[model samples]
Target: MVTLDKDLASIQEVRDLLNAAKTAQQTLATMSQEQINKICEAMAQAAYDNREKLAKMANEETGFGIWQDKVVKNSFASKFVWDYIKDMKTVGILKEDNEKKIIDVAVPVGVIAGLIPSTNPTSTVIYKALIALKAGNGIVFSPHPNALNAILETIKIISVAAESAGCPKGAIGCMMKPTMQGTAELMKHQDTSLILATGGSAMVKAAYSSGTPAIGVGPGNGPAYIEKSADIPLAVKRILDSKTFDNGTICASEQSIIAETSNKTAVVAELKRQGAYFLSTEESAKLEKYIMRANGSMNPQIVGKSVQAIAQLTGLTVPASARVLIAEETRVGHKVPYSREKLAPILAFYTVDNWEEACELSMEILYQEGAGHTMMIHSQDDRIIRAFGLKKPVSRVLVNTPGALGGIGATTNMAPALTLGCGAVGGSSTSDNISPENLFNVRRIAYGVRELEELRETPAPYTETASINEDLLVDTLVERILAKLQ
Candidate 1:
């Protein structure tokens, strides 16, 4: 309810925050690994401890997503980040050498400026702050106006742990108030060595194009396709769980469903079983036009409405218990506002007669909202999944699971995260979930040709006679051996 004046914080305030972050980065560089781990653990514990409070804050502030699901999101950010970086060596001295020759090292990238979104405010607040700390970098946060209070409070909790662990004061600094101009200032600040940006297209674009280097995430228009081979019932159950969770505020949540005509009936039945209510043809036609703008953009008013609420918005009557509002098969690229990430439990369905049609329509739907985001297909057919993955123009193609949670595990078994990086077409550099590893840098030590022998003086490539000549060879022989030396 508190609206921040754009001028609440001036240029001087931004300067102070930057100075503190720089000091914190230096402090981190001098800290021991034990100190780093202690601080990280404290952050993880604080997130877990305040899960309920954090969820409440997010729901009340954003008026989007369910509270319980936000709890899971916050907990995931804390625990997953800690586990991902636990074994990662970022502290003290990490030296790769030939026997003992210095090769590559791990170096922190100075100060990081992070932009937290309204959708997953507290989770991202903790996640970005912790990752920067893990990398021995100081961090500054620009919270979305909708979730500023939640973000600032979370930062306070983390600052306590960081300072107690001997981290330099101001290691984790955030603006008491943020504005369009203020955020732009932070992004362009020379003191901010790195930008970790998440949110709308304009913000991400600014971060990427700002002379400073940044890791930017794009918008998500994840589409779920169900082929003939899929278990219609199971797919429906999983899709409903993913779509309805947190009122579909997640960027990776399923935006559209493409199912085979043969399985449409069965899928719809299961969807109903999972608390979804299917609308009549007339109802869908009315809602479709109502939810979308003439230009095809989603109407913001419908962004986070519940299934039943959306039904009412279209002049239909559905029980309050309904978790998902289903609109029957529509043409590909149909401009229904409902398909454009309502951020709610409303699902737009498309039925195709053949796999090719399904693929084509699924890609079209994804392109409509997320040209470079994520698409998922639930099927046992590797060929189908492979086809979708290779051809959809989407950054990520998840198989057999919902786009929101399952897509995060596309490259690793890491916990399903809230932040997804929609790639180029989707207007992002990443095609997968953003993780802490992205925040760190890998410093390489290249030796001059003359220095190569000296660098590897003590290390023998191969013990055999043939090996000696092999080691002398460049491409595979030398490079492979050097790679193994690490």
Candidate 2:
């Protein structure tokens, strides 16, 4: 009875939030780009100012990721994202082509349903709010229950700042009482224009199935391939740095390392030199059992955990200096936990005979789970880099950089985003990095370039046409033949 009451309350709360968001979005949609920018600036500053506090709150509430790293993420979501999108035009006439006599107008997609994840709850909220508002759209967040406090706190801060800066009230809101029914209601609501979902595969699938246009990101099991011609130490260092960043909570972080057999010795030596602890056969087996749940999903208890905590959980002893746990793995499947997305400071190591073999291995690993997400290759050879970029089934083929930072556009020229789309190949609607531009639609205005007679002037193939003239000629010939027969 209590559970039923809670669910009913959540559904009612979703309805209220949706109504408020719809009204706020209508007001926001009427504002000019400059006015929207002012509100976005205020919200970014507010989020940046409270970055540390919110990071600590998220860590304390969810017990995931490092507070220090979360601070960096918060800064990225606010300052970096704002800097990248501050100059952009998202309203009114965005483009004009004098020669073609065409104009492009940007249109906001109204209220956006944002699904916040537990790993980066506060930062995700800040990022989504910034992008949604930058596009002159209102956002209603469905926060992860585990990180509700941080999500709500971030939303409150941003909403206050935005309203103070001449933004409409209720432009940014979050579901304080989060439940499955509430989130479903929020997504399927008639007023919800789009869903920007960033969570597990099941949650993303649900978002797509909610009868709303959704840009959902899927699970990432990216593999970092260290070619023979690459800088072994630098590659290993970047991988370790990325995997250990926020304790490997980022989806784009590398889950496995594929190195050429010619460079296997050097790769292993560099990995060990950079604080990687390789597990024994027995240790790997023992840890594998705890990597996934009985139902084959990632175990929440081990996500974003430190090496020491993970060691304790699996009853393995390792040096205090260890930064990441490495397991030599050959198989790739859902049953093989080591070859899957661990979301912690853990890695699977594979050796290949050459770059070709390394490419095949990387493809195999990604196809097993993370296709159309991200892949990294460290190679000085431009040909090899281009080859991987052309053949790999990933949205981002990062070259000579950390997967986590590069994929999110911190170390690369790509758009900075918390939600990285995996594309249709990965069962997502888009392969973009989820920017403000994605939150809006464009209306094209084109003048008639040619006369209607010009279309009829072009000749078509005989087989392509079934015109009335041909039919009349055929009928005439048939009549003539019938008359001759008579």
Every model's TM-score:
0.85, 0.93
For model 1, how does the per-residue alpha-carbon lDDT over 192-277 read when each residue is reduced to its tens digit?
A: 88898887767888998888887787767677888989987888877887888778877778977877878888877778787887
Clashing pairs in 2: none
Superposing all C-alpha atoms, what RMSD in Å does each candidate have to the true structure? 8.5, 5.1
Model 2, which residues run further than 4 Å from truth?
1-4, 458-486
* lDDT string, candidate 2, 225-298, tens digits: 99888988889889998999999999999999998878898899989998999999999999999999999999
lDDT of each: 0.76, 0.94
* RMSD in Å for model 2: 5.1
Error of 2 at 389 (Å): 0.6
Clash totals for all candidate models? 4, 0
Candidate 1 whole-model C-alpha lDDT, 0 to 1: 0.76
